[model samples]
Target: MIPIGMIDALPFGNSRRVRNANKFTELKASIAIRGVIQSVLLRPAADRFEIIAGYGRWLACLELGLTEIPALIKPLSDEEALEHQMEENLNREDLNIIDECKAVQQLSAFYNGDRQAIADRLAWTMKKVNERIEILKCCDEVLEAVTNGTITVGHAMILAPFSTKLQQGTLSKILTEKWTVSYLRERASKGQQNLALAKFDTAACNTCPHNSAAQSGLFGLEDQKAACSQPNCFKEKTASWLEIRKAELTEQYGTVLLIQQIDESDRNTVDSLVVGEEQFSVGCQACEKRVVLIDDRLGRALGSTYENQCIDNLCFSKCVSALTSPTPIIENEELLVAALENELGNTTPTISTETAPLKAKKAKTEVSCVVPKKVIETNKAMLRQTSVDLLMPQECFQLAMTYAALKRLTSNYKSINKELSNPNRFEDTFKAALRLNVSDLKAEIQNITLHLASIESDQTINITNMMIDNITFAADAKAVAVAKWIPTKEILSEYTIGSLSALCIKAGVDKAMDSKKEGGFSTASSAGKGKFVDAILAAEFDWSGFAPDEYIALIK
Candidate 1:
């Protein structure tokens, strides 16, 4: 046991095999409760001690604020320390297969790259050591699947003999279709003696030592060479030869192309294709890889567009890669110029200074696009009005509705324009636009009604009623808010009898009734609504006293 200073002298590769980060907390707690039960292993160094196997215990000691840790000191070289650490970590039952393989690799390095020596040192058979080593050579997917228990180590061994592409396909099928080991073995065996490979040199394959059919010393004493096997070699060579031919065809045609299968029903015309009875136009212009044909013999012999069909009738891999990778998006001239000053400062030497005058001239030309004086005045008149533009949008919208309703009540409302002393063109525009706005409002209301019908809830009625009240409130608020001088008499004709009664009552209707005889009340009622409305508007009135329902009723 010796004193420990800082916990930095040792590398953590051998000590880092842990299932969870909670183990650190648990180790720390254990040290706090009972102190380090096992001493941290240390190797002698120039300045301090290098940790061998007890890194967690050291960390726990450091966390407990203990300056010294109980450590077994050993005078050993780097390889000897690493070997000791690997042996210590590998003995732990909690080590996963990945960490186990890594420990084995480290231990093997200690034996001067001799797996047999490592096997002898650990008392593990050479075959078992090699089997675990081969696990590392398998693809990451296979490793993950094996670790997850989706596929067994035996399945990985069988798949290890195939090409990476085939291995990936088999893994995908195993995951998607839940393939059994026997099913995978059968599928793999069938491909080894396929009809495609049978045509090529049978005599050569029968006697060939590389062929799996030969069955002698298939397992080499050294590392296995999966690519040198019969089935894989034949397929790879054939693919390479065809790839060369495909490249030649591309060179002859002088353009990239994409080949797609067309349904037999739609094969009469060269202009289009069909996929399962659904016709799609494949015009030369629509083709993504329509090469520019030089007007030569081959160009004339075949049309301008050539389908990317290979001699073996397979879609090219490069075409799929091209489809997956989109073309770089380019910014337009307008966008470039707009952001040019921010993007390219005066210090930037990329864009030439000589072109500055031309750019400035173009900018001036764009800025000088003439707008007519009439249009400028009209726009100013539309937007600059303080009286109308200052009103809340909701209030203005309601006023528009009121005006539209009034215009419908009065067929010749346009002729009866009693302009205010201080004229408002907005009110005049509202009167002019009344008909159009009414149509839009009706369509909007219809859509709202349809939408409301689809929703069934306890709040539906409340929501609908609230919407109605809001629209009515905005319109009524704007309608009675008189500015400058209003033509109250002209507006009276659009008002209903209920509105007339409300207005008259608001204007001291009881007082008017007292002055006139009670017998004349019947006369006033019988005189028709036109004269009564005129009389009511001519009379001095306070409309503010009326309820909102009564006030808005005039517009309705």
Candidate 2:
């Protein structure tokens, strides 16, 4: 078996489907532990292989670090290869709904040319299929929901009966209100019936009694003529006049009533209120005279008509009261101060006198109580002098291994805590980090870890596992395992390398220890030196060498 590094990726095949399936970390782990048992199907190419059936297996093997993966290279025509590729993907359970719908449509066309039969084959009724098609006709609002995986086919089906405009409006409202599918369905049903009924009622009201009253002219001279000529004309005239009278009374009694054209400006204020030949009239219920208050605008009679009626009596009383009322005046600050001093003169005052020394002591106590606290000094010297030493090779190795193990544990934790975190798997992130093989950048790693901790605390899901997995994959596991034994933040804050090395040996990784011919101290020193050198060499490379010039230039 060749080393896994020698194998190249398969060419001329669908990469998207392969990548999606490989997102299953369990599958990747299985391939990692067990050698690839089955071979992938491929079509023979000039120099490369065209993957047909086992794309997932091929990706898994690559991830597992297998140098030469087992592949069954077949010499098939283009048409045959295409058929095999399609069949393989068709069998996958993770096929998206859009693809499934398109497949049904295509297959239906290929078979009996009847779409309904195709829908039947899929266990979906003709109506259901039609609804799905209608969802496709929906505007961006509904389509965006489908694409974003926010709304399901069932939800879209429920909305199918609505016209595009209505669907868009409803969809917007649903999103804004954060409504569930059930709520949306209920609202749609009720809204449709209510909207239809409202339209009908509004159309009917356009010709109803209240609306037609203004157009019927019963309050005008035509109504007066009708009243004099017809037998029931007086009743009709009274009804119309009463309706108009009630409206005017309602307006007059309403809170914060707007008295039409009552100018409050100094010059026009009283002039605008003056009543002239233009008479202001309102029908009164007390004595229906269609009361015309004339002369001044203050509801006063112009002539001596209906002098004994209740309307005339009430108007005269109101006008006389308003004319005789006193004008109001506002007081200034000097007058207010004089009034306050006069009020204070009627009250008694009390006084307490303290002896000289006691009074001085009381004043001092008050001053002290009112004063603010003094500022405390900070240990800025110690803070400025702080420096973190780079981790030795073994320490780095141990950390990487611990990160990998933690990554594996995080995956298990995520499965149990599905709703608690984001769906991005930590294992994948760890694997990527491991691929980088970082060991010498201990300070950077520590900073990153601290930043990540802050992010993990705020985020729904823990990405710590993915980060650890990536670091472990990039670095040597043996060295990482040794580093894991070192003291954590609390212990490291006080202890130096000499104190920590004993702890490392106790935790294991003493296997790589140097000869102790001179002494244990000498051996430990040698080991530390070797590990540090290894870490430095690993981190010194120019990573730009591996990237394309275009990418490097873009970064620059």
lDDT of each: 0.46, 0.38
Candidate 1, poorest ten consecutive residues by summed lDDT: 361-370
What's the TM-score of every candidate structure? 0.35, 0.27
Per-candidate clashes, comma-separated: 0, 27
Model 2, runs deviating above 4 Å = 1-23, 63-65, 73-80, 96-99, 102-149, 160-169, 178-183, 186-556
Residue 449 of model 1, lDDT score? 41
Who wins the TM-score comparison?
Answer: 1
Residue lDDT tens for model 1, 128-220? 777776665466688778777789877887776444556788899888998888888877665553322332344555566665545545465
Which candidate gets the maximum lDDT versus the true structure? 1
Tens-digit per-residue lDDT, 1-556, candidate 2? 3334433444334423323445567778777888677776776566555667776777677766667767677898644564466556656787665544444433332221245655665667877565544454344577668656777665676665445566777777777777788887776554422112121123443443333323455546242110112212322343354445434332222111111101111011111022111111111211121122111101111111211112222233333334344233323444444445556883422321222111111111100000000100011111111101122233444454444334433322232122323434334433333333454334334534444433232223333322322333233432433333322243222222222332233323233333322343334434543343332223323322132111111111
Please report how far candidate 1 places residue 320 from its true position, in Å: 45
Candidate 2 total steric clashes: 27
Point out the worst 10-residue segment of candidate 2 by lDDT.
367-376
Error of 2 at 409 (Å): 66
lDDT of 2 at 125: 81
